[model samples]
Structures are given as structure tokens and as C-alpha cells.
Target: MELRDIDLNLLVVFNELLHQGRVSAAARTLGMSQPAVSNALSRLRKLLGDDVFLNTSKGMVPTPLSERLAEPIAFALGTIHDTLNSKAEFDPATSARNFTVAMTDIGEISFLPALMKRLSEVAPGVTLSTVRNTAVNLREEMENARTDLAIGFLPDLQTGFFQRRLFSQRYVCLFRKGHPLAEQGITLKSFCAAEHVAIVAAGTGHGMVDESIQRAGITRKVRLQVPHFVAVGHILQTTDLIAVVPEAYAKRTLEPFDLETAVCPVKIPQIVINMLWHGRHHREPGNQWLRQTVFEEFSS
Candidate 1:
């Protein structure tokens, strides 16, 4: 294949197809029709003399050649975009860019409101959307620019991702304002005896607090299990069950329900919350502004 035969636009389509894994989705992302993307893929195949992607039951699965080409193509495209955009000033006050973030339910409660308020004051036209930071597809979403930022306790993000620590939080037990445990500070014995509500944030039955207890050879009677921290307040306010939650989140959410917070009886590691982004957007002006805004708000 000769350089003259390659269309730079075809490379763009190929990169999008690699990220999207389907011609239709790639078309949607590229603002092109499905047939246009398909034709571009065909052109790419002829130029490279390789069947770059194979249609599979699971969508477009890239061949070995396509897989090898993906990283360099994506990097070159990102560099071109960043180099061009970096010359333009990022005026947050007037720009109407939309940013997508991924975080757990706890992040929605603790961070979103304040971030929105700040954005409203600083960049009134800017908008934001939040999605769950499920363990399964976070890396792919970030790599593909589907999620602009992810803020949470993500210890699983690997290479090609950058992170900044927002804050460190420890476990706190939350209960109703007048719960018996609140009257006389909680002890390990009382904590173990009480019926607790465990939050399985990652769909795992055990969390950091549970692991701590297990390490100490102690066990607590978990009377209820919840998948989100938002439900814990309501359950604790109405029942005798207590919940172990992040200190920052509990401080913000528990107050509305007239709840009280106490330090966890078991020793658990401090949860370090971080804001993560992909290297692809590291130098892009809009993404830089967003990252700076978040850092100023949460890192302080």
C-alpha cells in the first residue's frame, strides 16, 4: 500500500470504528452515515491489503492488524487535535461544552451539587452528565472519550490513565439522631452486636469495613444489604439498622435525615477518592478546564 492511496479521513473513521466496535455507532460518533463509514472501512481494507475488522456476533471485532494500528492511530489523531485546540483559548464563561463524568452514587450525593453550582456561576452555558462507574467498562469508556472524567474510589484503572487525589475519607457509622448507639459512643462490642446495613457498592458482599472486621477476626450481623449509599439514609432513619459509609458522604447526606455520625469501631483503610481521565484528553483545552475546575473544588 502506498501513502497516496490512504485517505486521512478514512483513518479517522477507522479509529472511531475501533472505539465503537460497530459501523452504526461509528457513524453516529463521526456524524456520518452508516454507508459512509462502511465505505471508508472498505477503502482502508483495500489500502492496507488486510481485512481490518471482521463482523462478528459481538459487533465489529478488529483483526490483528487493526488491533496493532489502533493505538498509534488514536495517538496521532489525539496529538493533532490537541495541538490544534491548544492554540485556542478556553473561555469557560462563554464556551458551551458538555462534559460527561462517571462516578458512584455516593459521588452524585457528595460532589455533583457543588460542582453544578460552581459551573453555573463560572460557566453558565456549560453542562454535565453523570454515569455509573461500574467496574466492567470504565477503562474502555475513558479510552474512547465516552466519559470525560471519572471521580470515585477507583483502584483498578491501569495504564494510559491519569489520576489526582481529591481527598481521603474514612468509614463512619451512621444512625438516627436518637439511636441508642449515639447516646453512649459506639464500642467494638456494641458495633458487632447491632444489626447493620452493608452497602455492596461494587456488587461485592464485602466492602472495606467488612474486610477490616474480617482481618480482626470479628463479625457483624448484617441485617440488610443495599447497592447504593443513597438508600442507606432512609433505611437508617426508619429502622434500628446502622450503616458504614464514607465520612464525606455521610457528613453531607446524613444531615437531611437527622442522622448522627460516629467513627467506625473497626479499623479500615482510608478511602482515597481520585479524579481520573484518559491521556487522550490531557492537553485538550476544554478537558483541561474541566479538570482544573474539579481540582480546585475538591482538592482544596
Candidate 2:
């Protein structure tokens, strides 16, 4: 392929199409008409001398050639985007930039309110949109810029991602204020006998608490399994189910309801919370400012 034959704009369209996987969706993302995007794809195919993409029942599937080109094209685009952005100063107070954050529900409860209040005072024009973080796809999402940052207990991020430890939290058991377990402090025997509610954030019934219990050679009865920490309050308040959650989350829920928290009977390891971003955004001024803001606010 001749350098003169390549239109850089066509590569941008190709990258968007690769990410979106559908012509209409790519058009919306690129702010181009469907025909324009299709035309660009045609031009790219002709220039590259391969049918770069194929329309399938599932979506637009990239051919082997397209798959090979994806990384280099994306890297080049990212470099260009970051270079162009680096030239401009990022004044958060005046800039109307939207950032997408990926976090778990627990993270939302722990950080969103304080972060928003600080943002309102310091960066009135800035906006934040949050998406749930699933460790499975976090690396892909960040690399593609689908999420600017992910805040949670993500210990499995790949080598290419940059992560800053935000905080460390230990498990605390929460129960109704008047529950029998609350009267006398939690003990291994009582904790083992009580019916518990387990938070299965990773869709696995067993978590750190379970591991700790097993290590102590104690078998605790899990009467219920919940997907989120936010539901712990209502479940504990109305039912006799006790839940072991992060200390920060336990404290947050206790004030609103007649709930009490105590140290977990079984010793679970502290969870390390981190703010993760792709290396692609590591040097971008806007991302740097945001990362610094988060580090200053939450790193404890």
C-alpha cells in the first residue's frame, strides 16, 4: 500500500467500526452518516487490498487482516489523540469534559457523594458517568477508552494498565442494632451459628469472608446471597441475616438504619482498592488531573 493512498481519516473510521462492530453504531460514535462510514470502509478495504470487515449475523466481524491491523491502528490513533490533547491546557473549572468511570456499587456508595461534592466546587463544568466494573473486561474497556478509570478492588488488572492504590479495607459484620449478636460482641461460635447474607460481587458465592471462615475450620451457614452491598441494609434490617462487608460500606449503611457493626469473628485479609486506568491515558493532561484529584481525595 502506498502512503499517498492512505487517508488517516479512513483509519479513524476503521478503528471506530472495529470498536462499535456495527455500521449504525460506528456512525453514531464517529458523528458520521452511515453511508459515509461505509464509504470509508470501502476505501480502507481497497487501500489495504483485503475485505477488512465482513457483515455477519452477529455484527461486523473483522477479517484476519483487520484483526492484525487493529492494535497498530489503535495505538497510532491514541498517540495522535494524546499528542493533540497534550498541546492544550486542561482547565477543569472551565472545560466541559465528560469522563466515564467504571466502579462497583460498593465504590459508588463509598466515593461518589464526596467526589461529586468536590467536583462541583472545583470543576463545575466537568461531568462523570459511571459504569459497573466487571474484572473480566476491565482491561479491554480501559484500553479502548470505554472507561476513563475504574475504582474498586481489582487485583487482576493486566500489566499494561496503571493502577494506584486508593485505600485498604477490612471486613466488618453488620447486623440489626437490637439483634442478639449485637448485644454481646460477635464470637466465632455465634457467628458460625447465625444465618448470614453473603455478598457475591463476582457472581461466586464464596468470597474472602468464606475463605477466612474455612481457614478457621468453621462452617458458617449462608442463608442468602446478595449481588450488591447496597441491599445489605434492607436485608439485615428486616431479616435475621447478618452480612460481612467492607468497613467503609458497613459504616455508610449503619447510620441510615438501626444497624450495628463489629469486627468480623473470622480474620479476613484487607481488600486493596485501586483506581485503574489504561497506559494510553497515563500522560494525557486531563486524565492526569483527574487521577490526581481522585488520589488526593480517596487515597488513605
Candidate 3:
């Protein structure tokens, strides 16, 4: 609006006049009448108390004051124009963008290590952060750009979202290598008889596992229930309890906890993990790259 309490428009006229170097020429370039240009120059002279230009035999010559201010004014105007016109896309190697992805703890265990390793190799300056996918405001957060992407089985994020299927996860039973089931092998009867720890991932995509178990009419000896997969491996390793988990997640924990996985005896729903983002981010360069990274890393 104003520059140092002077009208910004006057500086525009001044810059054009400095370039054109004649009142009539500057007037035609600015789409203004010669009289209007003279009025603006008169006002600028009064404001700056300088004869900014001199009518010479050759042309309108810039005064010493005009020469002194020329470079900075040109630089400022050129910088603003370049910034407004720029369409530069994200460059991962040079970008310092911090992106947020929402996922379950299982998604974290199954996805983060490889993802981080790849990021370190290609996009070392880019950073990542995570939030629980089950958080109440997840959809709102994604729409608002606070959450950049989501990974896991998120059926509720259907409307106003774009998703790519990464893989379908089959259920498996995990137990410590020393557990009796490791020797006995899992059978329908043995599976139903064992003390089990169920992941109470209520009302989300993974909850379909429990819902399928219920609908199948196979009554398991339920010993404990937990809300997340973070401690399932350690809990089962220290106890006789066996927990049903995604096959990938079970395998990931197996060696670390000295656990063994047996084929789930009953038919339960297969969870389809997907990469999801708000429709708003469908064309954003950074979001596209991040989605591609997830698809490339975990997609089956």
C-alpha cells in the first residue's frame, strides 16, 4: 500500500521513468497520459525534496539521488515479480520439508525402518513426523494440511480422500519360541483352546479382524486384550499368551523377541493397507513424492 508513508504507486512510476528516461516515453509505457506522469513526478520531487531527473539535450537524465536508489528499487521489484511467478516443485535432496504421516503403531513397526533408510539415502534433509491414524481429528487434520499422509487400513477415510492399495495383510498367531504352541503347531482346536491376547483396535480398519473372528463363531480362550501392537511381542514373549497380528508385523517382531508365527487356523478378514491423502494434496509435489515413496517401499 505505502512505502515509508509514500504511495507505492509513485515508486512504480519512478522505476518506469528511470527505465524509459523521457516523460512521453514513460507515459506510453505506463499507459498514462504525459500530464499524469508529470503530476506524479512533481509529487515525488516534493516528497523526496530532490530533482530526481533532469531534462537534458539528449534525454531525461537521472539525477544523483535517482542513480543512488536505482539498483535497490530494481532489485526489490524484480524479486517480487520472480517470487509471484515461480512454480518450482519440491526437490527432495535439497528440501527441508517436515511431513506428517498418520499411522498405527503396527504401521510404524512395519513401515518406518525401510522408509527412514530410503529417506536417508535420497532425501537426507527432509524430515518425517507421525501421529496416530486413529486420532479423532485425523480427517480434519489431513484436510487442513497438518497431516500430509496416512498409511494403514483406513476405511473411514473414504470420502474426500485418495488412496492407493499397498498390500493385503493376512492374520497370523504370534508367540514366544518357547511357547507350547511352537511345538504343538496351531490347529483349529488348539488355537481355540490357547490363552490369547486380542488387540482391541476398536472401530477402525484393523477392528475388522476382531469382527471377523466374532462372526466365525470360534470361541477363543481370551486371556488379555490390548489396544495397540507396540507391546504385543514383548507381552507374548514373557507370557504364555499368543496374539493374532498381521503376518508382516509378526515376522518383524519374531527375531527381536525370539517369537514364532503359526498359520492362523480360522479364516479371518484380510486387512488391506493403503496409502491415503486428502484430495487437496493430490497434485502437490512433496505429497506425490511421499506417496510414491510409500507405494514403492511397502506396496505388494
Choose the strongest candidate by TM-score.
3
Model 3 earns a TM-score of: 0.76
TM-score of each: 0.71, 0.70, 0.76
The Cα RMSD in angstroms, rounded to one decimal, for candidate 3 relative to the true structure is 4.3
Across 1-300, the per-residue lDDT of candidate 2 in tens digits comes to 677868999999999999999999999998999999999999888888899999899999999999999999999999999998877579998989999998888889999999999999999999999987764476788889888998887767769888889888888899998899888888888998899998888732226777787888988799998777777898999887898888888888887888999988788888888888999999888999999999999999
* lDDT of each candidate versus the true structure: 0.87, 0.87, 0.89
Model 1 misplaced regions, further than 4 Å: 1-86, 203-206
RMSD of each: 15.9, 15.9, 4.3
**Over all chains combined, what TM-score does candidate 2 have?**
0.70
Global Cα lDDT for candidate 3: 0.89
User: Residue-wise lDDT of candidate 3 within 79-160, one digit each (tens)?
Assistant: 9889989876999999999999998888889989999999999999999999997765899999999999998888788899
Pairs clashing in candidate 3? none
Query: Number of clashing residue pairs in every model?
Result: 0, 0, 0
Report model 1's TM-score to 2 decimal places: 0.71
